[model samples]
Target: MASVNRFIQFNNETINTKMLHQMEMLAGALADAPYLKVTTRQLIEFRPSESSVSVSVFWRHRPKQIERNGYLSDIYLLGAGYWRHFSIRAWTKFKKASTELPNLKEQLLLCAEEFRLIEKISKERPGTADAFSVRESIYRDYHRDRYKQNKQKGFLADAFLNAAFLQLRGEEVPGSDGFKPLFFLWSGIFDAKSTRDCAIVVENMLPRLEYMLEEDMVHSYYTFGEAVENIPPFRYHEGIESEQRDQEEEIETIEEWFQSWHRETEISEAPAMEFELERGDSSYAEGGREEEGTGEIQQTAKGDSRGDHQEDNDAADRQTEKAAKQASGKFGSANNQVVYTEKRIQVQQDQRGNIEDWRRKQAPYVRALLRELKKRMTQRRQDVRHNLNAGRLSRNLLPLVIEERPKPFYRKTAPSKELDAVFCLLIDGSASMIDKLDETKQAVLLFHDVLRGLNVPHDIVMFYEDAYEASDAAQPNYFEWMHKLEDGNRDHAQEIVSMEAHEDNRDGFAIRWMTDRVNKRTEKHRFMLVFSDGEPSAYNYAENGVIDTANAVSEAKKQGIEVLHLFLSSEPTTEEQAAFYRMMYGNKSVSADSLEHFVEQTLRLLKRTLHLVIQSG
Candidate 1:
């Protein structure tokens, strides 16, 4: 018997990397796509809320933890295979729209979208179909168990979701008396007997599932409003007192008034579902849409098992509308007022002394680097005789070639390469960086000095968000440029040394800001390097900081900019810490254990950067 001894310690636990890698291979095969190109940020672990391993835009990779806890082969592929279809732009739009909907509705729509995408992607990628089938079954079983536990909450939502899931798997669902009456009464249209029927109804309700981001303005209330309008009214006994009947009548009158008040202002028709079965098309449809008005009752039900028709749905609609408005209003102003202003600061006298001292200490390494770079830049020209061939007479040496054998002629041209490059160094100036400020300054000094020696045009910017002053009206994001791209010298060396800790760090915004500057540069090579002691941390950004930063990095890559992260820290001892850094930086991140090792790590990074640039060039 072989021993399962391969392990890596993370957060004080031993994890089996071998097993985790095996799972990755299995996932890649099951996905029928190329291996997801494992990045440090990809963490596979057990989430009780998730039946199988899944990757959400919210997923942060925890490699060590996943290595320790082996996962079921099939369940792990559920998420891995699904994530294969994720695209940055498409995902951002999907996420934003999902946030606008109710929690239950959002989950339902997300599941439907996933099923649709997986089904489509699986057709060309062999094993994906099997994996998708397994995922659907697991999802159905999990939801069924959850519904069983909460049976008293009513199964209308569950049934709607279940039917779609089953239909997605090409299975039929038996008719249910309990949910049939409620669904028909609520929709005033479809009485779904099979899973396919329910799927058609759900797709019609959320037609913007595939193109949510493309919509000009997301009207979240329309779908729920239509659903509410058909909900059967609750009834009272025929022998009820006159006073009670009057009270009910008055409530109904108010409900009618509220609905009418908002109806004219709200969007009435949801954009129709545009189904296309082509593989590369911008559609999520795997099949044709049901004909309009088919199986629809068209008449609203007046009574149901809950007794007299009640105006409860009206209240629900009102609440949904209010919540949507509040959410929209909060970000509207902030989005409108996104302003970026840059300022230059002179190096302080005290900081100049420190900069001079560091410059002297780094003189030898700087000289060596400068000499190598200059040597590479210099080109020597060689002359060669032309118009001569081994089998023919040479024009210039025709007499010698005629007497002996002919020599081939060659031509030489001096090809000089100027290192056309632009560099943007983004420094994290958050409160958490207070302890690491001195080390950060030293590293920035080294970076500035090295580039200065090579005459490379670069910018150094420190970014932070003022949390206390942040609001819907204005978000106070600061970018203090120690060295502008055009600064071009060690003149602002003091400013680099003067960098201090600020409030909070919004990494994604900062990266994007720097990326824009680099994008405008004419340099053939561009690099945006981030220096941060921790993951993105800011007011209201804790939950999404990692994902947002990852997306920002991805965006930069798409624009032909090389984005890298220098994870500045004393030491990262936990898997969570490692995962967080990887999540933000992907594989293009480096770490320094302490201030003492900063120089060594920086040197290694510089060497690697130069090699990549030269190789690619």
Candidate 2:
């Protein structure tokens, strides 16, 4: 087997390469890295580039004992236009990976002793078959907003990070087979290393950059098959339907009405499915008008217990159900078997025409949809109690009366029920972390598991508003739905992320979309969570809206909804950081000394904010 070697090379024109300082930093800082990958490996390569003088950036973040936290592949895709030179720094592992020259081995030990910490010293980063996956979430100094900073700065950081990330990998991310690189780029910024000056700036900085910086911050979410344009288009002085938009999608500019018709269809390689056939367990609460007056409705199995869960059989059942209902309506037949109901006709007219055809076309999608609907119903139940206490809802709901038989009438006093806590997950479909959707998915999985474990009632609603690729939404019984989609395969979600959840997605739009509907919807013990990098633009960012969000919190507080906010920073360059604190928490939020200790930083913040809200409730 070939020895897994490492090395570094510099282009011929290496000038002010910060080489010595870089090597110095890598050596001493190995143990203090952001990730553990760096601390274990060394470097090897061909002739060292005088232009790009290098010292292996190695690290050793071995825990006293190595234990694995669930492994999920994270990929970062750079948005367009944004770019910078040497501004992006490396975590110790990347620094070591960059300097892979075998000849420099002896020199490395001698040249940088300050960096030579507890890890003795090694001639080469030794490994035979595999050291680390090529497509790991190589840590670059992430000081951007979603990770660390705010919108504008985050965009700048994203451009610089993308350039740096691509340069390190030395190529485009792989797709068909192995792994891919996920750049933590963004919406407002879009230019990477695009110009001659851009490359000159970068080339002038690094002695041995492996991947070439292609361009600067041009909005990647918009270009699709073309060049990434500038973000907001509003700021670029262009509307969503500017001249550059494909004429067909030009009609998508209408903010409130972008069609996600292909939402399920686009989730996979398969075609569309009939809604009824796919509506596995009609879990929607059979209450109110939607489910009224059916003489003791019999329950169908949420799913068949038999292991051979055939998509075809599910399809047949749906068809048979509809037909039987339709025939009963038209021919006054018995309530059994297929004959074509109003629902059946509609299902047949859909892309799947025949119930069987639809199932064949979209088996997995149908199941996922059914799962999402069930979650929504579960969440709504939690709100009923909270709304009544707040006086926003009719507290005098006369007891569940069996028509006039129970004869239950509204009493003089208000009645209340123990409202279930409604969990509303506002999924950020922004383009910042496009490739590393596994992180997002992992986040959803983690939060859902934690809540469900506690038997907390909640709902998952996906949000995205990227005009170019369009947008989509969903609410699902997360545990079952995510597991089904993953098929227990957790690694590749980053690669298959939906296009709509890219750089162009807007947070303001997502928040408003959820809130507009939420205003009318009822959920007591309500909690609405916003998960995003906080990159909403001037047009999208509404003070009134944030005020509206605050009011929602106030309303939730009144109803004891227990509103909470969890801001996940993707970069470290927040403008004031306090701004998010003041807005999300009451003003005066930035007591956070530094978030370098990410786990502590976020966890503490979430606990503090949540505690405050609960106390307010």
Judge candidate 2 at residue 21 and give its lDDT: 26
Worst 10 contiguous positions by lDDT, candidate 2: 72-81
lDDT of 2: 0.30
- Please write out the lDDT profile of model 2 over residues 325-426, one tens digit for every residue: 211111110101112111111111232233234234334533443354344444443433332223343444553343343322322222232223445566
Tens digit per residue, CA lDDT, model 1, 328-362: 11121112223334555334676666777888988
Query: What is the Cα-based lDDT of residue 447 in candidate 2?
Result: 45
lDDT of 1: 0.52
Once fitted onto the true fold, the runs of candidate 2 whose alpha carbons sit more than 4 angstroms away are: 1-419, 469-500, 506-509, 512-524, 538-560, 573-575, 584-617
- Model 1 segments more than 4 A misplaced: 1-132, 143-337, 379-418, 573-576, 614-617
Q: Which candidate achieves the best TM-score against the true structure?
A: 1
